[model samples]
Target: MQERTFQLLGLLGFILSGMFFTAAGIKSGDLLTLGGSLVWILACLIWLIPVLRDKDQER
Candidate 1:
């Protein structure tokens, strides 16, 4: 259950980060903002996948 929660949260973060970066990029036109968003999005993807897969295997 904890793993499931982590996976869900991670996925949510990934999605939200994408949205945030898009808005930030449009609003500020700052490379750093866009870069930070990309980094967060990638982190979410990387962490979520392994956690989710581990949860599935446990089941």
Candidate 2:
């Protein structure tokens, strides 16, 4: 259950960060914000991997 929670949070973070990056990029054209968004996306993917692997193993 805790793992599931982390997965959900990661997904939520991924989505929110994407939106934030888009908005900030459009408004400010900042490289730092763009890079930060990429990092957030990578982190979310990393966080989700274990859950995805477990699900695959169940099949």
User: Which structure among the candidates has the greatest lDDT?
Assistant: 1
Q: Which 10 residues in a row give candidate 1 its minimum summed lDDT?
A: 1-10
TM-score of model 1 relative to the true fold?
0.68
Write candidate 1's Cα lDDT for 20-50 as tens digits: 8868886998887877777777877787787
lDDT of 2 by residue, 12-54 (tens): 8776877789678768988888777778777777877877788
lDDT of candidates 1 onward, in order: 0.78, 0.77
Pairs of residues clashing in candidate 2: none
> TM-score for each prediction?
0.68, 0.61
After superposition, candidate 2 runs with Cα above 4 Å error: 1-6
